[model samples]
Target chain A: MPLGLNSPQIVLLGVNHNTAPVEVRERLSLSGSNTPALRLFAELPSCEEVVFLSTCNRVEVLVSTNRLDEIRESITKLWLDRGKMDSNTLQGALYEYHGTSAIRHLFRVASSLDSMVVGEPQILGQLKDAYRMASEAKTAGLVLNRLLHKAFSVAKRIRTETRIASHAVSISYAAVELAKKIFGDLTGKNGMLIGAGEMAELAAQHLIAGGADKLVVANRTLSRAVELSRSLGGSAISLEEVGDALVDADIVISSTGAPGIILSKDQVKRIMRPRRHRLLFFIDIAVPRDIDPKVNDIDNVYLYDIDDLKGVIEFNKAEREKEASKADRMVEAEVIKFMAWMESLNVVPVIQHLQEKAEAVRQKEILRSHKVIESLNDEQQKAMDVLTRSIVQKILHDPIVYIKKGAQKKNSEMILDAACSLFGIDGLEDTQKLQDKCLSDANQDKTIRKPSPN
Target chain B: MHKFLFQITVFIYFVSTVGFLVHIITLRKDAERIATVVLSVGFGFHTAAVLMRWFVGGHPPLVNLHDSLSFLAWAMVGSFLLFQWRCKLKSLGAFVIPFAMIIMTASSFQSKEILPLPPVLKSIWLPIHAIICLFADAVFALAFCIAIMYLLQERQIKKKRLGAVFQRLPSLETLDAMNERCLTVGFPLLTLGIVTGSIWAEKAWGSYWSWDPKETWSLITWFIYAALFHQRLTVGWRGRKAAIMTIIGFAVLVFTFLGVSLLLSGAHSYATWLK
Candidate 1:
């Protein structure tokens, strides 16, 4: 008596990388704002089963909707309240999807196909957490339950089958990717980290992992320098000591938020004089860039900026793309299979009724035949009854085959109604009457478990 | 037949060189293809002309500098044609055909008349010196092409000019592999040529180490190439540094082939095209 998976209609509203900046995403961050939103959603008569996914690159609210217009408006108002602007203010930046499009969009988002980095796996987990929070608040229902479960399964299929999620996820990883392509491995090489900034720290960590020795971190502040030394397990040197440190530094990464060039062209030239022209890897990650752009003119010097790293980043992105395509194909296949299962759901009750009626017929026919066989003997009558039951089962087999075929090709409901009319069958009416109660009981506040092996 | 074929071969070479130079300045592949076709025509005629000279002169064409240079260049054209057939390496011939044409044209300036040699040139070393040196020189000429490509490719990569020509050029790793393969094959052949030349020197000059201008320059060219070979295998040298060194080696090769004959006075004066 499960209430047929009657979802309110599906609706999707979101802002993504192209429409919103980091600042906009930070303002609408779901970090501490879910409580009031959940209460408001429950208060809305038409809204049910909400899954809110909020990440740095995307902000989306997917919810069940019996009233599509009211839900789309309500979701847009939430954006308006957060931005303190008119609902139409975000019109240019916002995208809305309904029905099957909403389902497909959510599958894409949860699968990371829509991610800025594309193929990154965090969004799926974020999506799962969002669904879990909704279920806890008693917002999710039968349609939502099945949809979330399918979304998770589709995401899992995509990750396993596609190349989208096949690459490094962090800044340090991208840096290492670039270095590995440049010099296969940095074993036996000495590297210097300048300015203990966040970007420099990340690059240094990757270089050390790549088998390079962290010779020193040259910084302006000594106490902050000592912290970097203890943290990185490398020596700390004063900013004045950078020039002295240049000769032995094979790979120099600088990320100070300096106003101008920290390592000038003249200093690198002076350094070249003493080093007998050894190879130099100058990585600048400052906003204005720490190293001079002209330093690339030096022979044997390989200088790379954030923009230069973009090419390598794009390569990593391409790797993700290849994996994503595989994942997409996998998702497509699973979606087809899931759709088939959904269609099968349609005729399940009719098939169940047909099965019940067949059993009743076998039981009645066997009882009648037993009475007729009383003339034979006690053991012979039982044998005759068994033969009668077998015959009834065989007689019902062809109709059962046609019913199953009808379930697959035509609508299950249509096939079931036709079969009921033909057989003059009128049982299981109680099941149709108890749809809401069954749906509520079936959902019963249980979380849809994610369907991938840990 | 030999004379007429040689005229046709020289004509094709001249036209193809003009075609390539114009095409390169225009940045047109259509023009380049036309140039390549002309070069192929030249090669066919050049091959026939050499075979005819062999039939008419009654010996192999490697008897003297003039015939040896022409015949070797024809073999180089064959090598290039075979390379193009196997791989999409026609872009290479745009640089190479001009070189082959230069050698052929330079040989043309020298007499094509058959002349009997003195006792020194009359020895069995005549064919041995001509064949080994010329064929090995052809391989080195190919190596020279790869080296220049290596340098240009490196510059384009460093400058981040990823244009059609840049893309059309083989990958840096691929060019390095090709350069290494060519050097490896050419180096040993050159070594053999030097060894045979030393033996010939001993028989002709009564001393193998007299340091004739051509001999001295040949040894210098040999030393440069040997250094390049050693550095690549042992020192792991390649890319820009290796490319520059290769350019330097080619300069010395020019000096050995042209320098001793053109500017410096030497016993190998008969090998000069200036005569």
Candidate 2:
């Protein structure tokens, strides 16, 4: 259904990793609390409700307003002013969606379909935080409160219904996944870290999280090893002790800056006997590789350099994309449902006003004929009251049905206007207020009821 | 009646084998459960058939090639069921059930006639020697399947392919542990089987160390396993090496159990008994 002039419309404006380069996003990114941004948006003359969402990858403003163009222009100006950037530099970087598409975009963002790394979970949490900030600032009124909650539930639904977020898509996580495949469970397994690189440290942390019992950090600089080990709850050893440590370590991640191979096939082979040929996994994430490629040929020794981990990430990325298409369809279906809810909001006020007017007229006429009622018996007066109420309800039933049915059609605004004018109810302002109350009541009911997609 | 039950057992094994294969392809939990349940039912029928044969023939049903093959299938299923009860290795049946089905089918093809027990076979050591040896063979069969899975999974990790087979198979460490467990249990039983067979042979044929084809091959198989067991204990020959050795040992064991009887003329040959 097309929105009328007076009906509130949703508008989303943002610059994401896809639409802007890192430099541009960095300039536009709102890093901390979004309270100031929420207040600024709420103070826009035409904007009724707002939720400001900002993250490392995206900065977005979701707003409900009567005048979409005015709100869009003002928000864009305010965003550019906040980022201290001129309009010409960000002209091509900005993107906007309106009405139903805006709802769809919010859903996609909430579900991480719009993330730089699609299906990453942090965006949903960031969105929730932004929404909470807006709510605390009293900037997120009925429309935004309902919209953000719907977005969260949609994200939850997609997460459960599809395998979009189940696979590991990062280097360290891929290492953990492969480790699990080779070792089944990493519980009580020894892990050896042979470098102080960030990626290597992260991989070691993931191994520890995956239940590896102990970690040994061996680096050329004993001080760096000690520093890293202190944070990881692991022991630090000199580089000379790596050979001895290899015998005890079940999983080894080597990212040393050595120009040549640090662990060779012969060394691994000699240690295999001492290791009782237990399965040994090596993740060599360093450039110019720290472990020999032929080390994998040694029985029970598995070595994966950076390229292999990337290959795994690529495979998992493809798998996630396949699941993402399924999630997209779910989001599309939900957007339609929310749009229908918005459409029903249009007719709710008119229907309420028509019924209220009929009841008021009935009560006024009853009061006007009080003398005749006083002349009648109490039982007759009771029948007179029931008869008048039933007549009013019967009279309004067909019109209410007509208005609800019309709301689902393309000419809903026209039908609504005709119903309002014919009833002599100049109720546009009253309609807005009534719709807000109705939506708030619906929101309360939503919290108390089971969360169904419908 | 026993012949009919054996036929039913074979049919049920074929069905369960299909179920397990489907489970491997689809990776459906219900398929695995149904396959396990159906295999248990088939094992029940197989046990009944073997017991019925023992009662009717007045022997332990270890006389001819037909009875031996059927009994081997029964032993394999029993051991597999025992393992299934203890472990969570559900995909194992995909590799194992087909082997049992093939043996059952082979047993069905052989003559089902119940011959009178030969005088040489009429001894108290018959059941003990045959049952222990067949049970050891069953355990070795389990190791063989587990070894194959280990190689497949190890190949995926080393090659870094990580395909569908990689996803379905258990971890290399778990498979190797299962392989080691099989060896630990199967080796002692094999040693005891050989000892008991030697005793029975001396009592029956007046010789314990015959150069018969079956006896010689069994000795060779025993030596291979003994070496593997020794190295595994002392030097830690595990994972790929252990997996390969388990496979090789099973091959030799199979030849001693089957090829010696079918191809080579020996005291243990069913051909001699049939004559």
Candidate 3:
């Protein structure tokens, strides 16, 4: 693809969960502390700036370079060597986006629209970590710096303006959300997990992560309960002890394989006095439902079977999908704005250089006539300064407007090159110098103005 | 002048009520903050109005229905501000400020003319009795709002239909704890108010035990709260039971404050003096 002479071409190449299986992702994933990989990407001859992001779901290399083909070949070779995979095997798994599409992809990723679960928040943190790593490795320069920061703000805007991440989308998370609604903060609240079912264990884990004070594992088999308790950093109790545990436990996840209800409304009612009628939440994920549905009848006691949790997850997932479309539109608008800024980066330096060249000529003429001007009064000298400055501004105004307007169109580089050659401005070297200066100035402004990341 | 200040205070409270209602719908922190600031300013104006009434009337402003209702609204705002400071329950104001606004609006419609102090109300016990009782009423009013919130939140959780109110209301435990706090504070005040009322009654009426309609209703209100307070401490009667009892207790307290005077005639009938 033909590109502007000074525009930094952004290219993104990656394999995410949708593109590759876990096995391939695992092989290609870089550890958080992988500064070496970032350094290698930055040191590539064709890569002007680089940021390497490797999460559990994706391994993406974002580079700003003119020689895209060379960088793509080198990045592919390095990825293949690291993953021990052949080109043909990885060919179908790899995906690439160039220029504006690359930027849109980055923005979508930061906003979590490209997440495996669509609205999960971990990707933004992972992206931030990658950006931080690149900064520390001196791999991300002017272009990547601005791009990543823009991505962060775009993510924040989407989060605040859209409800994409506001709902629980998984069964275990839904259970925890309901518990929070009932009990508010989970701090100091005790949880009891009955049976060793995978779903029950996962719910227990979520409760503990939500700040539940303690966990008690109860199972028909004492050894299994002990092993699960050991892994979960909680105590173990036999199935017979589950009744006694009810008084102390505030949240209970019961998933026993029993044919009959293990916890009944009458049994919970009997324990209510001892429990002080504190809120009780029971998540019964068993096929037949380990806790009787009638237990929900007890005041301050809430029961949700697997189907109920699935209902919540489905409702929330639908809500999130609705919000995700809104977020996608917001991301699209932000991408356009950012791409405009990127396009301006190409023309901004040329405009500045044109102004500088005219000022230089004007100043040289003024100095050449300095002896003649010494006879003039101070007011006349001030007038001479203003006169020469405005003359230079008027002479360069149309060309500057033409270049900026051209930057907004597809044939911007042609207009920019024509303007440069007509003005006798060196097309390549001076543009590079001025672009570097402009980028540094922008970087300084960003450092001063950036809000502290939340 | 004091009446004008009171009107301005009511207007400011109305504005704050709107602010809080908007805050509830938008869930904006800045809206809450602005509403709280507006409410505080109104509270200041309210304080000045009450003090001006006290100064101009040459007595504590708790004699007639208008004065007592104004005092009641003032005390409610005071209690709410205190709880808001301590608990930071953001949506509590959304429930509470509107109630205060209604009380102030009701007070506005009542006769604001200051009457000559009644001989029966002319004693040290008048201020002590009326102030303590009305302050207790204010605290119970707060508990009433919290109970409503608790019920709404509990219903949302029980029905498994978490809605906007569920998200805004605090946890069941927090509301219950606040209820218990109000009970602990308001119960003692009620007891003291009754004690002072009887002592004032003995001094003024030549007898301490009269089954006057207001006095009898006050006793009944006391009994309900005492029972709830007793059960809460001893048998741990709380959550739904406590919330329901609080609502019932507040209802009876309101009746003792207003219903007896308007609906029934007795020595405690301040409505007779209004005419």
Candidate 4:
């Protein structure tokens, strides 16, 4: 992709859950290198502000800088170091979204509309945790804090006030449901789980393929299998007697740590003779090897390993995408809300600036004509002051009116920028400083205000 | 100054009340703002006229039927001003200012003789009681305005009209907050006023609970408003239910203020201000 010359003042450089893999991500986890990345981010002379959100799925560096080339260089160097990439390999596999798109992306990510799992609630909490940690580390400041908080509020409105989260089934729930469909009323069924994992425990629960006549937990370690069996209301069996277990078992799910196949073709063939090829279902779930591929060729045997689960997962993925379309609509509305908040921020400063400017003009003119104004005397001056203030207020009202109208359209930013530029709103520098100081300080003075009885 | 301001006050308030009706039903902004300004001007004129009456009459202006009606009208406007400060329901001036103006007109028609103050109303507590109750009523009236706005806004949202009025009107949540705030401030004030009035009534009538139309309707008013506040806080009341309840509460207050006084021929015998 060609990079535009008029790139945004700030650019984001990173991969998210949408890009990159777990193996590549785990190494670049921000926790390992820790303070150096943040220090470097701060130390870079061109980088005004920096925030890094490093989740298991993604590692990103958000920088505030008008200098694009310099920020890009620093970000690229950081990525290479984190990814342990060769210099030549920095060619592709990286992406950038600038300015509005970048901010919108942050909002979406914080709201979890862009998560690997659609409408998954955990991403929001994770993002918040990242933001909080950044704050405590003195890495995330006012801009990020405000952006994140506003994003959270937008998300909250979407979650509470919309049906965006309705009927969102978890992966575990889908897995169990699939199991029940395959088993078709699991009463008086004998099943053996070859490994004792959380998945097996969950599968053994009453929600899923339960009500087995006998449940066997076979593991390399007999104690572990025994413990798993006890927790899951089943019996323990050894990996050595795996063939014997397979003979009696109506269903077999094998997920064990084996350097090679524990149940080879020869073993299954012998078991077939003893068991008379009883209609058995075999599910091999281990990463390397648990059951032999040749064993699947036996007659009256149905086999579905991890690879077959992929097809089912793909179907689930498509369904999740359909649900995510609904979530996306919610996200779009939420983005508009957040934009409104940001626009309101833009309008507020301009309003305050206008008010202050008008007040200054009124005070200066009154003070300049103090002697001539004395004909009005004390009572008349007070009345005239009130009248003058009202006139000023009336005069000062129209732009705020327009600004409010423009607020709904997200045009407030352009309006504010133009106003600040046109009026030479240098006072805003002081205002910005004041805002930062307020944020940095502890908010100890909390008051619950109740109006006085009329 | 006294007679001139009084007539102008009554005229402007009456005109603004028409404006209020126009704005409330048609929901016109210019009419609303105009009504607010007109009623504000009327309030200014009323204050001037009432001040003159007190100064010229050499009394607290609660001395006779005429004086008391004038005082009641003054109290209503005063209460309206107090609420308008916080409530931001200046549109309500169209309804309330006319009510006040009509009371002033009624006072003008009453016998202008300066009768001696009844010993019952002579106590310092009577003014305080009257002031607090009237102000609480104003707050309730403001809540009624919020409730109306809430209903209108709710209707617009439900219909998805998204018009200018809908845009300007605060959200249902905001209106709910305003209604709650009004009740929060108004309730205790009403409580104090009722306590004071009851104490003064005990001294004069030799019984606190006389079941006079005024007293009975006042309790009814209190019960209705108290129920509104309770329903809102306790029952998680919002939107149409709260809005309808608020409207009903205001109707009860108006009935206590006007109906019990005129139609019912109670101890509170104020001649009908409306022609």
Which tens-of-lDDT digit does each residue in A109-151 have in candidate 3?
Answer: 9999888787899999999999999898888988999999999
The lDDT per prediction is 0.71, 0.85, 0.85, 0.64
Poorest 10 consecutive residues by lDDT, candidate 3 chain B = B266-275
At residue A169, what lDDT does model 2 achieve?
A: 95
Q: After superposition, how far is residue B158 of candidate 4 from its true place, in Å?
A: 46
Chain B alone, TM-score, model 2: 0.97
Q: Specify the highest-TM-score model's number.
A: 3
For residue B155, model 1's alpha carbon misses the true position, in angstroms, by 4.2
**Candidate 1 lDDT, tens digit per residue, B129-239?**
767777767877877887787677656546644333553455554566667777887789888888888888889888777787878888898999999999887756766
Show the lowest summed lDDT stretch of 10 residues, model 3 chain A.
Answer: A445-454
Q: Is the docking of candidate 4 incorrect, acceptable, medium or high quality?
A: incorrect
Ranking by lDDT: 2, 3, 1, 4
Q: Ten consecutive residues with minimal summed lDDT in candidate 2 chain A?
A: A445-454
Q: What DockQ does candidate 3 score?
A: 0.42
Give stretches of model 4 more than 4 Å off.
A1-10, A16-36, A43-49, A64-88, A107-122, A137-143, A150-174, A179-224, A231-310, A336-349, A372-391, A410-454, B1-275
Model 4, span A138-201: residue lDDT tens:
7665556676777787667656644345322543344333343334445666778887767656
Kindly provide the TM-score obtained by chain B of candidate 4 when compared with the true chain B.
Answer: 0.75
The weakest ten consecutive residues by lDDT in model 4 chain A span A442-451
Model 2 bad stretches (over 4 Å): A1-10, A26-35, A45-49, A64-74, A77-91, A98-100, A138-150, A153-169, A261-265, A329-454, B1-85, B101-134, B191-216, B265-275
Candidate 3 residue runs with Cα over 4 Å from true position: A1-4, A11-47, A52-61, A65-101, A129-139, A156-166, A319-340, A351-454
